[model samples]
Target chain A: MRNSIITILKKELKRVFLDRKLAFAVFIMPGLTIAIIYSLMGGMIEKLDDDAHEHITVVQTINMPHDFRLAAEALYGTGMIIEENEPTEKDKAVQKVISGDSDVLLVFDENFIGDNREGLPGVTRYANSIKDFSIRGGYMADSVLESMRKNILSERLGGVDEATVFTINREDVAKTEEKAGKAISMLLPMLLTVFLFAGAMQVGMDTIAGEKERGTIATMLLTPVKRSHIAIGKMLSLAIVSLASCLSSLAGVLISLPFSNTMFGGGFNFSDLAYGVSDFLLLIVQMVAMALSFVSIICLISALAKNIKEAGGYIAPAYMVILVMSMSTMFMQPEGVWSYMLPIYGNILSIKNILMFKYTHTSGLISLASTILFASVLAWLMVRAFYSERIMKSS
Target chain B: MIEVKNISKTFKLSKKQRTLDGTKNKFKIAVENITFKAKPGEIYGLLGPNGAGKTTVLRCIATLIKPDKGSIIVDGSSVLEDSREVRSKLCLLTNELKVDPNFTAEYLFGFFGRLYGMNDSEILKRKKILFEEFGIDEFADVKTSDMSSGMKQKLSIAISLVHDPKVIIFDEPTNGLDVITARAVTDYLKKLRGEGKTVIISTHIMTVAEKLCDRIGLIIEGGIAAEGTLNELLEKTGAADLDDAFFSIYKKTRENVS
Candidate 1:
């Protein structure tokens, strides 16, 4: 490292770390805020799920067979209450369901007669689809009736063994590690990219544009140090700082995982991810490269802007573009060698492949190389801006 | 010694700037054919009004901005081709340039000194001398934002001189300073000049120009209207003092520019 570059880098680090309030806002608050929000959101969603599960529904039945009560009890579980059929008119019974007074209306055709042995009788179920209680009641009613019919068919065939021609069994053969990888691969890559970009932006705008606005940059520009060194120094310091923020937010996500398990269907522990040290190391390396690209882009934008507000305006669209790219990874699979050369999108896909245990060295190399090339170009542009007129414009 | 040779700079104006400045032209000529020399052990002052291209010329000489044409040489180094070497030889103090507000005086001094490639002992020695002279020792550890404006200005001067360069350039040296602080700053410039340093400053104050400067260049409308000693200016303009001489020159220069 050049001595001037080291001096500049040290000063940049000192500017952030020496102020306790700024350090906390830049480093800890982003992650802490994310954890609190995720936990709160997870709690709300879990509560909704629990409520829908536990609510008992009221069922109104017309001419329901008495012989089916035992079958219904065995199949429907405890969330439904079957009302005694009080000889109510059919129209009135349906009106009860429509008015939301009753959860479901079960109408047995006249031919059912408790002895559909002569002719198969139809059962019509009516319930509002929009209401959670009505929807559950409708499902329960269908399941109970279906169970009774199957039982009757079995009895008529003289034995359940003779009733079934063949059995179809279903099982998941995927390992727990594969299951976890599948679960996290859907979300983690996009989340990581967004978090890392946010971390980069938090300090990057102030590093250059803020200095220009305050006229502090011209003071530094008067120094004998090379302008390229100043640009690199600010960029390196931002990468390190933003990476710290990204790690903090990652920790927050990890901490919130247990609380959010209900939303993801609680099951195996984190050990199920089953990543080795090499896997973790590769992931970190890819993420660090991604951070470099983010820092380079942010520095370039800041260098072009006259003040922090203008820098923010220019940066917000870039953030949205990256966000859309990362989000596109959710619905996509790593396709080919060409896909790994598409800048930020490629890096995210590569990260997704790593988590899903689908990464190849060729894919990783292409992604890393493309990112470094892109970031190098941006870093070079930032240095040029420092050397030219754009950086000195103050409005 | 510092020599500014036929430097010219023009700024492209944005729509907003054009409207604010009330000019239809797309470019504003900041400095044109500006040339001067400041020798060791002498004070050379650029006497001009606010928009007379004083700061622009100084900025070009400081290597902060490149001129559209021509060059500046500071201690035998070209500002354009050898900017880093030129910057190493000269120091600029201006109201528009400032240290970071978040930094303490002591830290900034050390930071800039290190940027100049000074060892800690050399920085400490300069700090001891400069801080004491500027009364900055009392608030050396205080953040620039928390300090008074006078204190901040003084610290800016001290930090600019951390390398103890051969050429000293100040723009509006007494701007935003109290009388006492201004006097202290002027006295320090004199001491620096006495130590065989080349000192150039831009000011509109006739009294400061008359008393502080060994020679004066009257700049008007991006051009040097006249250049002479105070006595020479008085004699040439047929005026009794620098104030009368300046107005006589200003009227003639404005007529010529129009």
Candidate 2:
């Protein structure tokens, strides 16, 4: 039995690794494509950010007093192109804001400086709400008018302190590193589960179902090798291959991690996650177990199918099932030890625990054990399938 | 020596299979109460037309599938009770089973040899002998996917013989081969028989059974219609050749196609 497993494992490995085209397609292509696309996207996003920062908002004002215009010109001159000495028609100035030519338009009454008439002077501010530039320009114009009012009140009332009302102070107390770790914990579990299964699916279907379709599996069965050994050997090799494929794609993402902030339009670093070596080791185990569980499920399904196409037909639904199970982890908190003892979801929860610094060795090991046990059961069923004549039925 | 005693097999037909076969019965009896023995140093052939259960009998002996009743013994090991032992002593080759297209003949030869529990030096020696015997040495490096159909067939035959088993089984050995490749296979079977191996085959071809098989069993509708030497069959049917004798018996014992 040992010899049979070794023989089958060697042959399977050689089938993939010795063929240059197959090796490249399965191992390197996924990572390379992700890296290339991420770089291209990141570069374009950074350019747009730089362009938006350098823009100057055009503020157009009408029917303003000379003193008030001078005060506004002194205040926002750096980022605003103030045009108080230009055209003063309210409709004409408002048209500029509507056409996207000017960012903001402010119009006041003809005798706005005389404060003893009825009450405060009336002013109308117009800017396109959809455009960030116009919205920002309008806010700047409001602040300028408020400052003039404050200065006038301070001189008449004999104190700037009385005109300013009670002052308020703002404070933020969020932990940056903890928040970053929480984000990783929530997303990494779901993504890791999806990727491990996807990698296994990409090759698992072809390994068993394709061989059955071509009648090559029968050639192996024709030997003296025990049927169970064939099952174990194939499943073990598949898990290793799936892990390799997953890691390849992960490496692609890792290589582009420095640029991911710009690529995804976010500013958080994964390095802020202060996980110890033991936590990383536990995460690695969970990942391997997850890969095993996924490959075993696919192989069990593939064994039931007579051809690769039929295997694919069956596995597409299984993918949805794994997806739903993995996606549930995104919205759920770890419930209990039992919740961490489910199959794929268990592995995901364990990874989540490790990321969020809530992991216990007992729960982590239980999750790993449960995943392995599930995979072993599936492997046993696949062995029974290999022993049966159903596997030999081509049509 | 190989002995198959009173073996019968029935298949449960799926709904679609029942429709295609136009049969109301849920089960189709593939073989029934069949008995045969193949001794060393002789090539025993199961001769029949399509669906006569010739391949089924060969498969039963190879332990690819089980007989619902009865038993098959290869040497001293029962096919059902000691399948691995029987398999270690036997090899089955069919057109449907093939080599991995991604691998070369040499690599697969070593692979199967090791699966049969041979050491590296033993596999090297055996591979050299088989590869040269069947002229597979010329294309040992070529992948089965890239080789011609005839070459692939030749490679499969060479690889099957890597263990050099005591019992040799072939199903339609030359069903889809050129004259030269078919000749090489039949000649190899003859050579194995000369070395005192128990050789059995199933075929619908008249010339193969007439020229290669030492003894022939005529099968019809999943039962043995007649069993004897070529001359004995000719004498029994009062016919000149195997073709006439087969038709004479077929006409007597034929039933529904299924």
Which candidate has the top score in lDDT? 1
Give stretches of model 2 more than 4 Å off.
A57-179, A263-271, A324-332, A335-338, B255-258
Candidate 2 per-residue lDDT, tens place, B34-85, comes to 8999999999999999999999999889988999999999999999999999
Q: What is the lDDT of residue A371 in candidate 2?
A: 88
DockQ for every model comes to: 0.76, 0.81
Candidate 1 local lDDT, residue B18? 100
**Number of the predicted model whose DockQ against the real structure is largest:** 2
Per-residue C-alpha lDDT of model 1 across residues A1-395, encoded as one tens digit per residue: 29888888888888888889988987788878878888888798888778877887788887778755776778755767787575557788878888889889888776464554666677788898878778888988888887787777788899887777689999999888888887888888988899899988988999998998888998888889889999999999998888888898888888888777654445657778888898888899889999999999999999998899999999999999999999989887766789999887788988998898888899999999999999999999899999885456451
Model 1 achieves a DockQ score of: 0.76
The window of 10 residues in a row where model 1 chain A has the poorest summed lDDT is A110-119
Estimate, for each residue in A1-395, the C-alpha lDDT of model 2 and write its tens digit: 69788778777777778889878877898778767776777776877677666778787777776655665767866667777734436677778788888998877766777766677787888889988778877888888888778877887788999888788898756566666666767656776777788777877887899999888988888788888898888888888888888788778776766665564336777777677898778888888899888989999988989888999999999999889988888788777789978987888888887877878889888888998999989988888888878566662
lDDT of 1 by residue, B136-195 (tens): 999998999999989899999999999999999999999889999999999999999999
Q: What is the TM-score of chain B alone in each candidate?
A: 0.98, 0.97
lDDT of 1 at A251: 85
